[model samples]
Target chain A: MRAALYQAAGDVTVGDVPDAALAEPTDAVVRVLRSCICGSDLWSYRGVINRPAGSRLGHEFIGVVEEIGAAVTTLRAGDLVVAPFQWSDNTCPACRDGVQTRCDNGGTFGAPGTDGGQGEAVRVPQADGTLVVVPGGPDGVDEKLYPALLALSDVAGTGLHGAVLAGVAEGATVAVIGDGAVGLCAVLGARQVLGAERVVLMSRHDDRAALGRAFGATDVVAERGEAGIEAVRELTGGRGVRHVVEAVGTPEAWDMALGMARVGGTIGAVGVPHTTPQLGLFPPFRQHLTISLGVAPVRRYLPDLIDRVLAGSLDPGPVFDLELPLEQVADGYAAMSERRSIKTMLAG
Target chain B: MRAALYQAAGDVTVGDVPDAALAEPTDAVVRVLRSCICGSDLWSYRGVINRPAGSRLGHEFIGVVEEIGAAVTTLRAGDLVVAPFQWSDNTCPACRDGVQTRCDNGGTFGAPGTDGGQGEAVRVPQADGTLVVVPGGPDGVDEKLYPALLALSDVAGTGLHGAVLAGVAEGATVAVIGDGAVGLCAVLGARQVLGAERVVLMSRHDDRAALGRAFGATDVVAERGEAGIEAVRELTGGRGVRHVVEAVGTPEAWDMALGMARVGGTIGAVGVPHTTPQLGLFPPFRQHLTISLGVAPVRRYLPDLIDRVLAGSLDPGPVFDLELPLEQVADGYAAMSERRSIKTMLAG
Candidate 1:
């Protein structure tokens, strides 16, 4: 089998790798249908998020189950599914509450030097928990929609869940504080699901902001921190946004998220948190506020999104502006690393 | 009029002061039926919260409307009322939304040389918004319960509102981070209104803990910060509390409040924010959480609490164990400061 492997900062390659099989009794092997480069992937490739040598490089995917362990009951060969970013025993108490990402047995995929997806064929541990059978059938949704469905595996679901967590409501004014695929999806979530009245995308470039508007953003503010705060307040009757979705994982982004919320409004954050060594958050509260943090449980959002797509009410597939053969993995990383594309879809 | 004046951080004394008259068109001059001390008052007494010399010393009180300005319509002369600590017009959007404490025209009593009600008379501004005409025709309920009614002015209502803001609900397990009048009152709020399944009172004092239990705290932990977090987690099956009322204002108290909540829990804080330099509340996202901050809108809560008292179904009067003559204003602070009293009721 061949898979994209990390080499050094700003570099990656498709190389021959060992065969993958069921690593655990609950595990299965999936023949990748579609995979994509994520903003989070840039964190590792840019050396911002440290990665071990020769690690597989993707976590988001939609695939067909090629094989299943004897212990797996719900999944079998020929089944099509979307794998959420986190692997969890969906039966755990946390998962039952729709927070599967924090499940006691929740597992992380695509870590450097570990066996993860992103290959031609990938081993999926806890198959029953990680993979969801895309109800209608494997061919129920077209292949072009697969990458967007692939996005739902992590990015889209994460973004939408972020907005949902932030209490984005119908007719609400929202400010999305990041410009990644997740942020764009949050804009979609805000408008399509939550029915936000207006979504203000905070971005610097024409490209990202364009994607933001296509997703549902009514306005765009190109400011970063303090200025962005002023821009949002100016846009919101001199108060602040009623709901704010923070999709970037940085202290600056966190500040912007908190600052953009009205005195009594909410800030929902979905940026994967980097442990702050100091164990501190500086000046986030201002009299009355509700600050919610953490990664969104993508699994919990899968059903509603799949329904929307199947119903043909919303098409989140436009984020896949570019597509490539899986073998040309190097160009995908370069384009995304240099901010030339919103996201890249890879064909199996 | 004679009242206790806040002259300096540590100097609050009974002295002759100018008469308090109608300060606004919606103002009313109240002949205070009863007045009392609050923990917020102690901040000025300790000089932790700076105030100009000669400010009045009390904010919580029940009174008879002695006079009303032409603009005052909802309240009139001889009408007995339990006025909230902050005078609100109750007509603003914030007030209409039931958060009168944060009303646009709100003004605080006992704020550094201002005419607080720990006196013969005090001016109630925004009378229609701030004063609640105690129900039962004002003549039916016993006047002796005035001290407890006075609590609706701030302490009890603030704590109760904090829990309410934090979404303490029926069958929820609550953790209160302070053991002062407000903290214990928060226990009452949780048990009575929220119907908490279990209440954890963080207290190191036997007397306070006993009072906490009486006030509806189902469990008590004699620990602070991390240890307190451990105790609460242990009590909630090692998951953490579903609701935490942070009645303590310090950063450490805020930390403990965050530490105590389970993922998807809520934290309501109404601890008269002083020395609010920063906040550290990131861990709850892996657990979902809602953190709401603000003092209770007493005017909104007073009518309900008065009903509870009138029905004889609830009694929080035990919290004010000591009753003192208004002349010995210093003793009220001393009793609470020295731990000799859980709450002091100053008779006017």
Candidate 2:
């Protein structure tokens, strides 16, 4: 099988790898149908974060079950399914508590020995606990829905997780601090799904801002840093918003999220903190603020999000501004790394 | 009139000051019946935080309403009331949202021009909003209940706020990281008021630990730092508690609180962070944690706590291990500063 592999700084390639096969009774072989590059992948691509040479990359995918182990009960061969960024044994206390990302036996795909999602196939551990089957199998679903369904594997679910952490509710005023795919999704979820009365998207790019508006952002601010926070506060009558979705993990983005929250407000952060270290406690503490953050438990949200997508109420596929064939996975990475694409999709 | 004054570092004195009188249409004059030394008062006494020489000192008090301004309608002369550490209008958006500490027009009792709670009489601003009256008048309440009533002014309410921030709920497990008056109260509130199933108290002092046990701490770990975190983890089956109450403001205490929380847990901090600078975000972010912190909105919690106290379900008064007449206010400060007393009470 061919899979995306990290070679070194500024280098990624498609190369032949061992075929994914069921290694345990709890495992299932998935023939990936769609996969995509995540913003976090850029960390290793730019050498900002170290990755072992020749390691598999990517953690989002929608696929068909090629083979199921003897113990697999909930899924069968030929079933269409989405794999969350991380695999978890759903019976663990953490998974039962709705935080599958921290499940006792959970591990993310693309780690050293794990099968990467950006590949021809993946051997999924904890099969019954890790995969969510689509209502209709591969043949019943429209091919056009592939991008959105693949999104449920990571980005869309992550965005909704940010809104949930921020405690967005009916009539809430929210400020989304980034304009990436995840940020746009946060804006969409905070307004459309979470019922936020007002959502301000802090985006300097005209293209992303337009999409944000269509996705339910009530206002858009093109400013960054202090000016961006000021713009958000101005929109909320100088009190700032009650909920802030911090989709960018940079220190400046964290600061902006902090400054945009009113006293007694919350900041839900989802961005992987590659450059950021500490979130200064004093500022938020002084204002009685709440900060909820982490990688999204995408699996916990898959069913509902999948239903919403199939019902035609959600359309996050447009976030994938650039798509490439599996053989050109390198080009997809280059497009996202060079800022030429908001997100990249690879047809498997 | 006489009031406690901050003369300099390590110095506090009871001295003659201006008489308390109604200064605004919304103000009321309170004849203080009970006042107590708080852990926060030591910050200025030790010069950890700067305060103006000769400034009023103290923020918690229970008293009789001596006089009321023309616009004061909810309170009357001779009514018994307790004042939260900070004065708030209680009608502002922040106050309405149950975070009175951030009330738009609020100010602490010991601010330069404000009357200190450790005085014979206090000129309280925002009378209707700042004072919660005892059901019975000053004469109707027993003198034996004075200490408990005074606790409601700050310590008990602040402790409850910590549990609330940590999201203490039925059958939840909690860990309290301090054993001061506030920490002990948190133990009580988590188990008695908020219904936590089990509570672990991290305390090095035997006296405070005993009180913590009496306040419903299911277990006590006298260990500090890493050892303490280990002890807590062992008790919770290798997973830390889901809720942690950080009642001490030092960096070390904050770190311990962080270490004692399991993945997806919450840390509710009510300590005045005089020595701590920033809370490292990476650790919590990686664990998908939630941190809620600030100076507690004591006023918002006073009524319920008062009801609990009056019903004999709560008794945090024993946290005051030392008592002195108003003339010996300096002695009370020394006892608390020297660690010879858990807390001190001054009889007015």
Candidate 3:
């Protein structure tokens, strides 16, 4: 089967890889229907996050079950499904508490011996607990809904995670610190699900600014650094917002997220931080701030998001600004790495 | 009037100082009836926290209003009151939100030019906002209630703050990560107010362990560091507790607090951290933890704690194991610094 492999920094290609097969009794083989390039994927593609030679490189996919091992019960062959970024046993204590990312025996898709998402066929572990079956089998689903369904696997779920962690509620003034697809989705999550009264998105690009506004951002701050802080303060009438969603993992973004929150407020961060940052005890204490940081429990949120997408209340399809065939995966990476596309969806 | 002053790193002296008088329109002079040495106060006595020459020491007191400035409306002469560690205008936005420590124009008791709590009298700023009036004036209150009232100013309130921030709910398993007066108070707060099903206290001192049990600790973990983590895991069936109260400010205590919390659990810290602690983004993210770090907004929790105290349901008086007159305030410092007493109460 052909799959994308990270050969080295600035080099990736679609090449023949091992065929996907069930390696465990609880596993299932999935023929990938749709896959995408993530902002996080750029970390390794740009040589920021080290990747060994010929490493499989994706953790988001929606697919059809090609085959299942003896122990797989809830799913069958040819079933349409979405797999969360990480495979988790939903019955674990952590999973029961809605933190499946911390499941006792779960791990990310690209770990050694696990299947990466950006491929024609992949193996899924703990299939019954990790895969969410779409209501309509492969036959009845609309082609246009692929992007939205694929988003529930990680992107949209992550944004919703940030919103939930921040405790966003009615009558809240929220700030989203990044303008990426996840950040834009956070604006949607805040306004649509959490009932935030107002949401401000910090965006430098005109394209993303438009997307952010479309995603329900009430305002956008274009400046960065101290100027950006001042801009947010100005918008908030000298005080900062009561809730902030940090969608970018840079230290500067973390600082801005903290700066954007008012006293007794919260900042929920979902970005994969690339830098080591020191949290100042005195400043956060003085502000009475609470910081909820981590990766999204994607599996925990995927079911609800899938329902939301199928219900036609949410349309995150536009986040994929570029689309191409699976063989053009390298071009997709280049487009995203060069910031020419917000995200790229590949038809596998 | 006499006030305790930190003469140097290891020396504190009580000597004649300027008479307590109202210096602002909103100020009030308090005739301090009871003051106590705090765990935080020992930081200076042990030379851990540097003190300038003759810096007024102490920040926990209960007193009677001796005189009032022109604008002091809610309090009057002869009224008994309990002042929080920090004085704040309850009318500020931050104060209105129940975080009075962040009140605009408010500060700690021993700050330069402010009257310290360990004195015969104190000139309080924002008199109406900073002082909580004791019912029936100073006449009906018994001397036995003095130490309990003093605890409201800092220790008990701080513990309550940790519980409140952690959002402790009924049936929750809680771990209080210190054996200090504040940690003991946290155990009480978790049981009495937060409805925690089980409360664990990490204590090394036999005396404090006994006090912890008396204060409602369901279990005691005497181990520290990795062993402490293992002990807590054992108590909770290999999973950590749902909530943690961090009363120790050191990085080790903070780490333990984080380590003790289950996935999606919270750790509320009231310790004043002395060292710069680096929060690893990936670890917290993977654990799905929320860390609420800060000093307690003492004034905000005082009224409820005061009610609890007056009802005879909660007593923090045992924490003050030694009593001394105001003139021998130096002995109070010596006893606490040498670990001869858990805390010292000074009679004014």
Top candidate, metric lDDT: 2
Give the CA lDDT, 0 to 100, for residue A330 in model 2. Answer: 91
After TM-score superposition, the amount by which residue B194's alpha carbon in candidate 1 deviates from its true location, in angstroms, is 1.4
Clashes of 2: 0
Q: How well is candidate 1 docked (DockQ)?
A: 0.44
How should the candidates be ordered by lDDT, best one leading?
2, 3, 1
User: Model 3's CAPRI class?
Assistant: medium
lDDT agreement of model 1 with the native = 0.80
Better of 2 and 3 by lDDT: 2
Fnat, 2 decimals, each candidate: 0.37, 0.77, 0.76
Q: Give the CAPRI rating of model 1.
A: acceptable
What clash pairs does model 1 have? A55-A113, B54-B113, B55-B113, B55-B114, B89-B129, B90-B129, B263-B287, B264-B288
Q: In CAPRI terms, where does candidate 2 land?
A: medium
lDDT of 1 by residue, B77-121 (tens): 888888888888777766776767668888788765457879989
The CA lDDT at B98 in model 2 is 92
Better of 1 and 2 by lDDT: 2
All models, DockQ values? 0.44, 0.76, 0.68
Compute the TM-score of each model's chain A versus the native chain A and list the values: 0.94, 0.98, 0.98
Q: What lDDT would each prediction earn against the true structure?
A: 0.80, 0.91, 0.88
